[model samples]
Target: MNLHQESSGEITLLKQKAFNLSSESIRDEIVSSAFRHTLAICQDVTKVKDQSKLLHTEKLDKILTSRLFGFPIMLAMLGIVIYLTIAGANVPSSMLASFFGWLEGYLSLGFQTINAPDWLHGVLVLGLYRGTSWVISVMLPPMAIFFPMFALLENYGYLPRVAFNMDRLFKKTGAHGKQSLTMAMGFGCNAAAIMSTRIIESPRERMLAILTNNFVPCNGRWPTLILLASIFMAAGFTGAAGTLVTAGVVVGMVVFGIIVTLAVSWVLSKTALKGVPTHYTLELPPYRKPQFMNTIIRATIDKSAFVLKRAIVIAAPAGVLTWILANIMVGDTSILMHIVQFLDPFAQQLGLDGFILMAFILGLPANEIVLPILLMGYLSTGAMIEVEDLDSLKKIFIDQGWTWITALNMMLFSLLHYPCGTTLINIYKETKSKKWTFLSFAIPTGLAIAVTFAIAQLARIFGWV
Candidate 1:
């Protein structure tokens, strides 16, 4: 036979051989071989002075990943991170707000000097500028503090331990072990989290991760959660105690979100995307000293700035549109008021007012602007505004008839609502299926509405509102 014929024959024989092998057996063989090789290498070259001796890192891991202590440690660590972010960001956030507030006056003066119309001033200085300022002031400090710390953990190789600690839970949920990692990524940005689902090899599990990742509140929702927790949940306490209580409440919300993630994953796996969980070995990397400066620089530029830029881009245009709605009157009321009135009955049933619901609806583009929009709508202002402190913010909510039920429900709703517009776009792009993308939105939104409605009804029945 000629060369071409010989090559074709060999290819046919290889295909037949591959076809004859069972997939399960092939996978078992591959895993066995990999383990065998690893054992052989370690046995041949590894050395220890004492067989029972453990390194400092290994000792720490033992406690960190212990069955009884692991979760509590994780929660404690999370609380510390959140507390630090909340406490540290307060001063900078205030300074930024004051600076922006001062700049707003100059902006208005300049607009007047140029003979700009009132509407023009409202849209530019009050709407876009104020919106952007709120995002930066409220979001930047926490992100600057949070992302670098998170990156440090990642650099030190602690994050994989987090995944490892949750592996059993995920497995029981019929989801991939790595879904925990993606969910962790969701804390930074759900869009990025959805993209990270590609790490999950099983199609069904990947889809499950994509659908449920939004259960973990992203950075955009943090401000709202912190604001509500500090003002309402921690109100009775004072000083450092109050601050600690606020952080604890925020951490509790995060834990609640994780619980929801696991529950939803379990439900989807058992129903819509039924499948066996795929098993993969996760090799824990040796812990090392983190490159502190490098981690900070990379996280700030790559994660923090990237996410903030997207929020600003979306928020600016939304702000302009919000201004128009608030200013454009139909009959005696503005268009914004009309829509709020239309949604009022439904919102009240959910322990929220029309303005709150409207803010959430308008905030679909970027969650960072939700509070600002709510403030503008409630105050009947044509532009977004910021208060000087928590007391001022609390007074506004109280004056608007906000009870504990409303604050609690707002936190719950914010936690469970549909992913932001950017996240939805990412889901569609990743899944390449409108059905799954729609389900992603529908599942969370339906859950949000159902949960808040149930809580509200129960509160009313018990006279807790």
Candidate 2:
């Protein structure tokens, strides 16, 4: 044979070899052998003199990973983190809101002094500045508190334990084990979580992770959840008890989101993304003492600031557009009023009003601005309103015919609806498939509508609404 024929034969042989080795059983046997060989050469060189410390660590791990106790412990830890965020964020959020409210007065005065037009002042100060301020005040505190706590867990190596605890559930759902990590990341920022799916080696599993990342509530949604829980759900209680109850409600929402994530992952796996789950080894790392300052700094700068910056960037332009829509009068009513009236019937079926639905639609650019937009619409102010406190906010909702059902459905919709513009863009970029990107939006939105409609109808039938 000539040289060309010889090269062709070699390439064909390699392809045949690859094909033969691609079976799951064959791959498992190869992995087992490799691990066995590595263990044969490796030795525990360090002698642990203190058996007490080792015993304590092992005992803790046993409890943490126990099937009966593991999930509860994980949830308890989550509740604690959220409780801390809710308690810690209130003071700073109020201060920031006050400062911004004071600054707005100056801005309005500056505009008038400079002879700026009413439209220009309204769009810039009443719309863009107000929106950005609301986002910062509401979003920054919870993130500042939540991210550092999350980072401390990460630094202490507890996060891997969480992933280990969640691995089996993911595997059963036909997703990669590392998807739990991405889901946790999603709690901080869905865009970042979507990006983190690169860690999954399998293309199919990675895509699954990206599609489901939005099921977890991100920092942008925290403000809405916190506000609603505080105003509507925890209204009966007062003081620290009320705050704790509010935190519990938020934690319940997080758990519900996780349940939705798993359910959707299962449905996707059985249908559009059918495949057997591939196994991968996850080595639990030894827990270490977390460096407090480093954890805070990194979490604040890398996670908190990164997410907040993206929200502000998207929210500013949305604020301008929202202002224009609210202010531009077509007939007897503003364009915003007309759109809200159009959506009222369908929104009513979902236990929400027209203004609430319109707020959510307009707030698609950034979830952080949803409540402010809703307030603007309800108040007929044609600009975002900054309430002094939760009481005032609650009163506004009451005036607008909001009840427990409205709050409940609103929270559920916020939890399950289509992702923000940033998350959608990231989904498209990561999947590079319009079909998957559309599914990413469609799946959650359909679920939101179905769930809210069912609950609203049932409540009405039972006279509970």
Candidate 3:
């Protein structure tokens, strides 16, 4: 009955009263488990909050993701990227073209010295060489510049903020917020983006992401857009201002593309694929110093090379086939000419011509191939022409009756259409359903047709033709 014994008895009685456990240890065990769970929950929230902080962001998020500034900042980022791709790409592309052209000359000289026939020289040195050269010269530089910047933003943890900002729109569209992240990946490569859709646990949302992913411009498409913008928009201005305006237009097109994507997603979710978009808890990782060497190596070796190889594989055959189409006569004209003539009506209706439309269809294997196909179609007329630089490309298009509207339509179609063959394959692999894959293909094509049709009609109504 001393004080110490009395205190011990009271503690035991309190524990027993709380849980009715015969053992005093049971109450302690329950309290410990609850505390651990509570601590874990708090840690998770803290981690999320800490990751959202931008060390050097300058409160930019307030403006960058604001309802007013969000769209404009997005456009600025896009324009800057495109401008960098265009202006920075020029020297490297010219160097690459010179090197490749030299190599071709050597290759042709060797073929002649070895007594190779004209047909062999034409097919190998001219056809395949010209096609693959365009891919390397045009694609390599922009990708080298663009991918690293993309990786830097991604590495700096800015992209997650982009996703966070976009989540609500995705939710409204009945798509997953994580779809924004996947769309970012699509800018690298649509196939990779489609694969990244796996991050979404919901099957329905994943399919939606896969189908809509191509709305974002992929690396392969950038060269085409940048080239188009520079030719039609930038060419008028001299020096730095021209560069800025070209970049701005290219960026504007991309922003327009994204707007179209969101609109299409909203429509699809409400109709063909109607459902609620599932929400995901995205934990933004901390911004770290981007490893420059690793990014260069990975972007060059992993991204650029991988994309290049696939494109070359597809382009070589496409080159040969294109050459054959251009060379082989169908009564009075080459098969390519006849085919272009046949499709001209529909192509014109879309504010493009048959050759451009044909290029797009053939280029479906790889967006890198479209310009090459168009070149082959043009060069096959025994012109002895060579596309030595971006300016030369502009000449070809102009000679072929290209107007501002043609360039605009080409850019729009490139932005709006279904992704390439590799992307389609990735979608099929990820979704594991042909029906959804078909839907993926159908939706984008349908939209591309509809949107271009409207633009074409508007242009004609305005007498811009």
Candidate 4:
């Protein structure tokens, strides 16, 4: 205790160690050598270890980490997780939607009963209330299901295996291998993913991960892609087959996003952030039994609710603005239509209408609200609308002149678009620089526009639309 307290000797000792950085090369080498020697001694001295457990872990690792099977297994596991989320959320989402619809009716009746002003009713009930409820109804169930499963997988120590498998690919792109772990976290939430970049030791590689993380569609954007896949891509199928197809498309998008992340990382390494890639040894922890219920509770409180709360906060006010825009007129047409019309010309070249583009702009605060915004814009109902019925949504899109091309492009655009406001804020916090924050937003937005434009044009040229 006396030695721990401050004294003249403490000052002398601190001065002696002040310039010794623990993470420096000399320190790392010393620690690495110590660990290696210790490990060798332990392995030699240990006897009659749990051979069954060791053999089981080794066998599982052999298959999961195989050169040929690793990527395929990773994709299949992703498909399964997505399938579970989509299938499990379907019934609950509809029930929530119905409950919200029922409550809205009573709220509207209460307003009318009190002789409330029509505009006030519209703002509070139709706009604010509807928008928030839309988020809860649509966003909650899927997130509720997805995050727990994701957390469970993470707790099982599978993410390091992912990093191990993708390390070679990332190294080729001049990025830190552990970026794969951060990128996997992105599947849950990009803001969280940005924060996770602290695990990477190299500032340049960390920035590469931060900038490219948005390409991987997060929890908020998955709803949009899943909805589109259900409505259009899987329309020809039914039951389990339909579900599988939707999951398959989502898996394909995820793979594409990863490819884009690598490509962008390579580009940045060669040009802006040019530097030799740093290397690190990744320790793959042994798998452990994840307590399912505890994981679910933690995931729900820590991830799902946090994201949903942020979405509701933004969606409510944005809903009012959308309602106002849709209601207030410029001459004969509503201001919303006027704006959509203005954007339509440019947006069409991207294979998306003005309303869709405008929705993307308005929904920048939260990706979960993008579909609801687009729905309300399409109907021009002066309020947000929540629809979980794929058939009805398909009909609405068809009425709006949507084709397979529109659906395909919408999925791509959603997958590739700008990071949400929350993610940008987190990026700024992580980077502590306005310059890199702007690049984080700009890089993905530009790529989304460029890629969608190229694909849309190619489809047109081939008469595929």
lDDT leader: 1
TM-score of each: 0.90, 0.91, 0.84, 0.90
lDDT tens per residue, model 4, 273-384: 9988776577778888999899999988876667567756776787788788888988999988898999999899999899999999888877878888899888777788
Give the distance in Å from residue 428's predicted Cα in candidate 1 to where it truly belongs: 1.2
Residues 385-416, model 2: lDDT tens digits: 87776787889899988998899899999999
Residue 318 deviation, candidate 4, in Å?
A: 1.5
Backbone N/Cα/C clashes per model: 0, 0, 0, 0
Off by over 4 Å in 3: 1-71, 382-386, 389-395
Tens digits of per-residue lDDT, candidate 3, 1-465, equal 654565566567656676755342454455554565555568757654454454545466566567877766665676676777778988998898788888988999999899998878877866677677767777788778878888877786678878877886787777888988888888778888888888889877777777788888887888778778878977778788988887788777767877777887888788877875654556556556788778767876677777578757866666666676777787989888888899899999999889888888878878887876777677665212346566778888889888898898889899988788888888888777899889888888988888888989999999987
| Model 2 TM-score on a 0 to 1 scale | 0.91
How displaced is residue 196 in candidate 1, in Å? 1.6
Structure candidate 1, residue pairs in collision: none
The lDDT for every candidate, in the order shown, is: 0.88, 0.87, 0.77, 0.86
- For the record, the alpha-carbon RMSD of candidate 2 to the native fold, in angstroms, is 6.8
Q: What are the C-alpha RMSDs, in order, of all predicted structures?
A: 6.8, 6.8, 8.8, 7.4
Question: Candidate 4: deviation at residue 103, Å?
Answer: 1.5
